[model samples]
Target: MKSRRRWRWRWEHRGFALGLALYTLLLLLLVSYMLDYGARRGRALGDWAWEGQPPPAPPPGEAAAPPAPRHEAKRNESEDSDEAGPGSRAGGKRHIYLHATWRTGSSFLGELFNQHPDVFYLYEPMWHMWQALYPGDALSLQGALRDMVRSLFRCDFSVLRLYAAPPGPRDPLAPFLPGGGGGGGVNLSTASIFGWRTNKVICSAPLCPAAPRARSDVGLVDGAACERSCPPRALRDLEAECRKYPVMVIKDVRLLELGALLPLLRDPELDLRVVQLFRDPRAVHNSRLKAKQALLRESIQVLRSRHRAAEPRGLPRRHPLLPPGAAAALAGVHPRQQHRAEFFLGGALEVICQAWLRDLLFSRRAPAWLRARYTQLRYEDLVLEPRAQLRRLLRFADLPSPPALEDFVLNMTRGAAYSSERPFLISARDAREAIHAWRERLSREQVREVEAACWEPMRLLAYPLSGQEDGDRQEGGTVPLQMFV
Candidate 1:
């Protein structure tokens, strides 16, 4: 009886041990599957997120265009230099950022700068990465990376906008879905705005994220506050960042406005160089009218509002409601064509965008970039004299104006072209008159309203005020040449 009992006990013990081992192995396998699944899921989402839409299909029998001529390397030169070499980091002294505003001949200027062998011309680095939440405010390092990672998981606009940073990019991607500047540097500079010398100084914010658990109840304030709350060390870090680079040129328009950018620019330590490019207000407005965008309404409204207020040459802006003021340079500058509400609103949009632009270029922002830290160039002048303007600009930026620039100009004009489109475009009159073009659809009252809306900005950019100037000149300003550089 005792032996039989012992045998039963042993059998039971063995069965229990075997069951426990099998269960452990099952758990391990499950965990492994989960880990693999998670990694693959993350990668799949990432691939989809970054993949751009495919090019439009060509019809049957239409061959793709022939390839352009490739540059043959000279035997003496290092091949790697022709492309961005592995040793390129050794040559990267400092970045030269060209902050190109929309419709402001940014590409033309970019190609021009790219002519110099040493200058690293970065085209809209920040603009390309925004998945859906593009056109957001400025940015920092950590926040930008988080947004990029989050963009992979979904294509939600509210979700996307939640992740945008206005200035540039931010970093960190361990866990994602984030929205997230101010400079840490402060230089007290007296700036004259509207003939009043206010002690217009900008203060900086340190670089740090807002508290992770902070609820997203309040929108802009939360963002601005979080930026404000950034640690002082980050501000110091940014200042130090510019120091390591020998010279950097930045040209993102999101940070261009005087009120928004002045504080960031007032850093005493930065020896920044800025180039302000001006487009004809009419052309700018015309482009704005034709632009198909999501967040553009706000910008268009801002433009239209400004145009209705002032004329070019410090003239009083026209307002259907406000009426024209005496000695207003912008008075009576209505286009002879019926105000195509959508198109002629260019008059309004140009007037408005240019007023602010004038302020940005010649006013407070101009002086800031123009300060020992900057240089200024006009796009009209550039189109008029690309070689001379570029050479002078190179000298101003402390870069050599290479003879190759002329050839570069030719190559860029004839060869390196990306899209066949005007840099700052004005819609042809017939198109402006079309039903979809906003001609047939717009009422005369609407035209007058838009014209009134455009009146101010027209005055500011010096659009022809039919009041004094003869309307003989074709389309307001100097006849523009090839704008895309």
Candidate 2:
């Protein structure tokens, strides 16, 4: 009996060991499958990352026929010709970069592209980049900025989310919830404008399953699952849309140095075109000053409110120059002294003129190949002759001028009136009046100061000298073209 019991126990142990081995094999298989699936997904995402170099030029005489007369035919012909090069045909899309300075009527020019049915327009995607690496903080930021722009051109906005994340607990705003939540909770609405704008644009697109959801709730569900699912899916949708559209346009005023972006123009995959929008330097300076004055008033009000709040809390005030007692004293000072102090302390107008000069110099020095792809448009020309100028711009961009384009120009400027005060909005009424309105607003001394600071650029760009030039000459005073070089 003892021998039989030993034999039975051994058999039972063998059976248990066999089951354990089988389970281990099954777990290994499952893990392997998951890893393979992830690899596949990653590969798919990378396929849309960048279009390799452009295709070699066709042999002489092998080029496609010239565009036909009909608008649709011309569009088709352009597409066919573009396909001759690999870079241009990468998913079949054309790209435009609208480079401008602040207060240059760029907002209105951007709207022209935004209103197009066939165009996928992005407004200042680099705003996130700027916020991440605020201009003067780092000198090595250009490479990173260029990479971000390249990703965006290919419809990969996932990188922008990294910059859009909320600040740490130490952030002043972190303690208050704008939506009535308790302290230490984040307010999605106020966290990052870049994120909010990105979310709005992504959710508004047709492919987002979460399109109906509110902007705050987007990509926040199911923890990591939503984060993983939303961006790739939206990017895939954007890629498909890019294939359908003939052109993609990105506009930004922060790209003051055109030379930094020349590399992108040379990229085969980008097929990039540049529209450099400039305004009269004096006008830009005047507009910037007006904006500063308005901002100063708003800031003064906010400072008073903060002082009122801090007094009850027994907290120290933040503004060194605007102490509670000093606030009243400031009102009695001359407005000109106040303006001078603001500009001197902030280095505002000087920086503006310097930037204009820097950008104009960089544009002038661009190489021949880069210049071939570059087109310059004046804010005055655009506002004064919207239809004609826009038509020229469209042709330069290699875009067909459909009836919709004409309607957009007309409708954009028809109802609104010009106002030096409202710099942010598009005013379609009286383009010529708006063009020369700076003459009436800016003091002669201020104009001369601007001219002295930006003499080379002002002369190069043909902006007439204020009050010093012949009235009969419509263009700015002539300087030797060699001076620009």
Candidate 3:
């Protein structure tokens, strides 16, 4: 009986020991789980705090880097008007900028690059890619930059809709810019290939008269407002396109005003290369007459209630340098007399010549940025020897001329079918009299008027017009503007 009781007590003690061991194991597991869970939660919270949101899927086939907090990885630089500003274009040090003038053969240049297998050329991007995010003053440097970034990421459909809606006098972009108009849908094709949204010249795209019922609508824009607000986008898109080709070309014709273009394009990261194409004064006069007539027609076509006769303004005053030979002969005319003189002598022709004379200097004294980035080219050289000229240009820009770039050149040379210059096309023929075309293109009286108007700008540009006596009559009818040697 005593032995049995001792054995039973020992068994009871063993059972008690087993229960305590099981309890201890469970407590240890619970503490370990709590610690592990806390660690994971801390890590996730830390990541969220740093990164604004989950990183987007990387570009196809490229590894997406882990997103740092939006604050951590973002750069704080000079304020840009919208997204895709200099920072975006410099997407890690690759950038290109093309500065070509209107009719300086830039459209052909655009075609030349757009044909490249690796190149995706964007035309006048400054005018085409603008998406004004809100209704207010035109895009500020900061505002433009931010909105461009938003364009890259999906926009608030509502904002895009508002930007797209048009037909109002004060375009949504008016506050941000001086003129009007905006681009249509984003070019998803460009974004997919080169990671950018690019457009050509900024023009009004006809869209159905639609209003944004919800956020999904991005309609078309009015035309003029586009001019005022699109430059930043053009600059931004060109900068992006350059990343892929590292050689982008652009021609913003609206940049006719120096006040509109230079500051935005002066960014160092853009690697801008400008080409100031020129023609002889004779050729300039010819082109100006055509341009004047065309503009006059355009004004008539767009004859708004506020018709301001869209004729070219004091173009002579625009330049500080006039040629000494052609212009110096007229230095004695007065201002009021010049306007009156236009009717008696070709007043229109005098205005053009004087403006051109002043521009020669103005072109030279352009801002340091343009001066540093540009190379001058003549129109004749571009047309006659495109390949050779392009090669030299490539060399200047530190780019290798491709073996088959001649193919591109052929397209430019052979693409357009313009009629050979007719006598009337280049200039009005000397009716019956042996016309001293240059001297007679503008009357002495008209020349005198221009001399006064063009003198100030001509002086600023240090224009040394060829100080030669105007022969009352050249031996034959010759336009002295050209060096026909």
Candidate 4:
């Protein structure tokens, strides 16, 4: 009887141990699957990605090495060399950043670089970064933004993949249907994902033979393939090409705080030159208002369409279910929405004026080394005398004043007429008219208000206040206080 009891106990215990081991193995597998799923979801969701705390820094000795200066332009090259053979990556590269705010003629300036066969131009790579961290969440976001830019400069476009992913189906019901049948789904073309004009120009350039072929069959390949194949290779070739080219230029309007990018300028590896572009405050404000109005009209139309669609489901005409904060957060992602939100929040003009003041002060206070790399360019000056200003700019950047450069400027400006309200198109017509057009557009009171808020910076930047300012102060009692609507 004792032998029999011992055998039974042993059998029970062995069975229980086996069961426990199997359960543990199954649990481990399940956890691994969950982690993989979460990572894939994160890549697809962009801003909604589960970006927990930032990763810890590497140990002191393991940190990344600073970039080395790779290329230096040859001053002895003939002017015709500008149109010569494929750009060589044999020497150190020249990097130029054209920093500006909205409504400034930065697009035109950027195009000047774009037209150069030897120059590889990037248009607002930071636009994706801004969308990912909209409303600028301060230190963390700022650090991320700078890091993204650093990666781009070094020819690593992997960071951009975070924002390049196509958003998953927003409507739940569509997934159940064949072909994910949602009529209004987000369609992200290669051109749209990358900039339209920038992509067109880059593809046609000699370095990217694969690009033009890929463009013809854009629908066949997925975004992932395009992301994998094009940007990385293009950037790599450009990095190599930089050795032969005089300069590589990047233009961005979102960099309102120039001081934040001081690290890049100070980097010994990067021969970075900064061109600070500013427009008249009044013109900037007016352009912003016009854009906001157009966007608001579009938003209203979208809301109405949603209301019509919801009627069959017995839903409210307005999306009353969303909290104000949630709606505002959604709106904040887009520039136009942010503009409207700011207008209602008041002090829109003050905000623009303050930005001008802050940037001017930051530029003025830059250290000697940084100041050496910096050059200020006014929109008025660029527009008024394209050839002379561009010649000066190229010389400052150490680029040859090739005849091709002259042809590019004349072709770009004369081909498209300049319009303050519509700045995307290049206009060669009298740029001076666009300069002070804001004076006539803004009312006397509005002009006075802007001038009052921005007098110091305006004076410092050499922008004269309208003579009507004195008259407005005298009639201050009767003049209704106006704000940006």
Choose 1 or 2, whichever is better by lDDT: 2
lDDT of 2 at 75: 26
Taking all chains together, each candidate's TM-score versus the true structure is 0.41, 0.59, 0.40, 0.57
lDDT (Cα, tens digit) per residue for candidate 2, span 1-485 = 89999999998989899989999999999999999988764332222212234334655664565533322331233334433332234443578999886677887888677655456677666666655553332123444666667776765555566555455122221122132111112232222222222233344444345544432231221222323334333333444444445677888765434555655776667778888887877777666666665334222322232212211011222222332432342343332444643454234434444445555555565555556677888777676568988888888777766676676676655545556344554445556555666778876556655655555556567665544356524532322222211
- Candidate lDDT (C-alpha), each: 0.37, 0.53, 0.37, 0.51
lDDT of 3 by residue, 1-485 (tens): 88899999999999999999999999999999999998764432221111122223347654454433222122223224234443443332212334433333454554444433333244443332232322221212223433332232221122333333332212222333333233344332221121121222222111111212211112222323434333333334333333333334434332222222333333333444555444333333333343454334222222221122211223323334445454456556545532222232234333433434433444454544345555655444555566877776666554556656665564445532332342112111222221123354654554355444444533333222323324332332222222111
Task: Give the worst 10-residue stretch by lDDT in candidate 4.
Answer: 476-485
lDDT of 4 by residue, 256-375 (tens): 345556556655455678887766676666555555543232223222322122111111122123333333323322223334533432244454455456566555545555566778
lDDT of 1 by residue, 1-485 (tens): 89999999999999999999999999999999999998764433222111223223445554355322112112113433334322222222333445435555565676455334333233333333342243332222213533332221111112223433343232211012123211111221111001001000011111233432221111112223333343333222332322222334443343222222222233222223456566544344444444434225334433434413322233233233434542354344455554245543453344445444444333432332235444445555555455777777776666655565654543433332222243222211221111122233344444344445554433444544334335533432333332212
Measured by lDDT, the strongest candidate is 2
Residue clash pairs of candidate 2: 54-87, 55-86, 413-428, 464-476
Clash number for each model: 47, 4, 48, 11
Model 2 has an lDDT value of: 0.53
Candidate 3: global Cα-lDDT? 0.37
RMSD of each: 24.6, 17.8, 22.2, 15.3
